[model samples]
Target: MKKKVLAAILAAAMAMACLAGCSSSSEEASSDAAETEEAAETEEAAEDAEAAGEETAETAPAADGELIRVGIINNDPNESGYRTANDADMKAMFTEENGYDASFAYSLKNDEQITAAQKFIQDEVDFLLLSAADTSGWDSVLQDAQNAGIGVILFDRTIDASEDLYLASIVSDMEQEGQTAVDWLESQGLEEYNIIHIQGVMGSAAQQGRTGALDAKVAESDNWNLVTQQTAEWNSEKAQQIVQSVIDAGTEFNVIYAENDDMAKGAVAALDKANISHGVGKDVIIMGFDCNKWALQELLDQNWNYDGQCNPFQASYIDEVIKKVVNGEEITEKTIILEEKGFDATTITAEDVEKYGI
Candidate 1:
């Protein structure tokens, strides 16, 4: 009877051990399943949050199809080929498809430009695109626009305002343009050449930039002589008049430094009428800026001399800035300098003109 009791106790012990082992194994499996489900849930939640963020970021501009009014203040469309091309570029970028409503005002005077800026500010435009007529008189206008909560962007011409006043400036370094032209002229090994420098609007950045290098050369070297220098006010007729005056005065000038192609064309027109030979490797060398297609063709046809490129197209880049800024993306640059090149009248081919001419 005692042996029977002992065997029953051992059987009870074995059954309890088996049950314990089974319970331990089941507990481990259940713990692993629970952990896997938790991990999946966490991952799914993270993915959902990421998707939400993307949609939110994309929704702001998508929802506001109302015209984001952008006001453009520029020099007159008849100013130059550069200005004309710039206007066309701006028009193309600010179309309905590009998600902006744009308006423009043109003036060659600072007061007029300031008035335009004030009007745009009153209209509550989202942004102001300014190509200032003069650099110095814009600080007050820019401050007013900033105070009114409108963003200002400088294009083509830069203002002398503090950096914080405007969002960004997309401009060609006018000083550098002049310097490049001077360097090219120096490379041609012309010494003791008399120059007739026809300037643009006297105090404007374009005129100031272009005249500096030549004036510096004259001041420093004294090898090249200034026959005559006059402000054409960037008008072709004024330019023609100035050149006619120079011709009538019997000025002994071998170099014509016109600030822009229009003035250069005007100078050349006077030269042609006076039966003066002008071009590269000719009796006179003409240097001009803003390589308009027609002006470049003149170079290709061996009529005009060197034509430097001043690319005036900036609206596409400005559009990119708008998309980034309005979308809350960080902008890496506050100033963008456009690259410019000088055309060698001796070697600039038709293909070069097509590819690189403004």
Candidate 2:
């Protein structure tokens, strides 16, 4: 009987040990499964993030494969008729149909443009296209873009940053434009150049370059005089006010060298108000830039003396540059200067206005 009791106790002890072993094995299996699931979830999250990035770049990929993400920084289109055509061309080029996922920002202020550029860098854009509002204060932004491995293309006006900062530039020779306009002005054989210099927005490339030639010419001679030199900030109303003030002060000015057509028109209004004859063989010789259709028409009609052509349509060239960037092709030219010309009241025609007017 004692032996039978020992046997029963041993069997009961063995059964308890078996149950404990099964329980521990089950817990270990559950722990292993949970770890595996967590790892898979982490990997999936990473993949989703990578996919989102690809989507931004390839929002509308071309037939080949990769998508080009571009950020365009420019000035307001409403600023001038020239700007209107420029912006429209850019819009037409960087469309979804053209395999580009482009974002655009427009501001007349340099600080605003810089801020927009920062955001584009943060968003990891593939390329940055800029038409700077100011020529200086752009080094920091360009450095940031370089650090991010993004390509930069400059269109319209250029900034004062180093050449290495940008991949390529498609721009007009603004200084040359000013020189051309001034040369034509010099050829007019005026008795004396009593000038009212109506400048564009201060610190702008166009303003600096256009003003440079006339300034040097004036400084070298005694016949040329500055009746009034001021900034109209690219507004026709402000330009009108400036000219009206000069007229009221009895300033003997016989020339209006406005940096743009709109300002020239404003100066013309002032002349008409005072019944001062202008245009061909008139009291004042008006010179303007940007060759807007109406401004060229004024030239054809012999109401304005000169109009300098500032080529605004650079979209096709920009598109070609961007394509090369995406395809890992080499850019041979760092700077691309557009062809431009000057128009005269005697030489301008209606057909010229229809063909070359922007």
lDDT score for candidate 2 against the true structure = 0.85
Q: Write the per-residue lDDT of candidate 2 for residues 299-319, one digit (tens) a residue.
A: 988999899999998886787
Candidate 2 deviant stretches above 4 angstroms: 1-67, 109-112, 135-141, 249-251, 326-329
User: What are the Cα lDDT values of the candidates?
Assistant: 0.81, 0.85
Task: Report the error of model 1 at residue 33, Å.
Answer: 54
The 10-residue segment of model 1 with minimum total lDDT is: 52-61
Candidate 1 yields a Cα-based lDDT of: 0.81
TM-scores for every candidate against the unseen true structure:
0.73, 0.74
Clash list (residue pairs), candidate 2: none
Model 1 lDDT at residue 264: 91
Q: In candidate 1, list every pair of residues with a backbone clash.
A: none
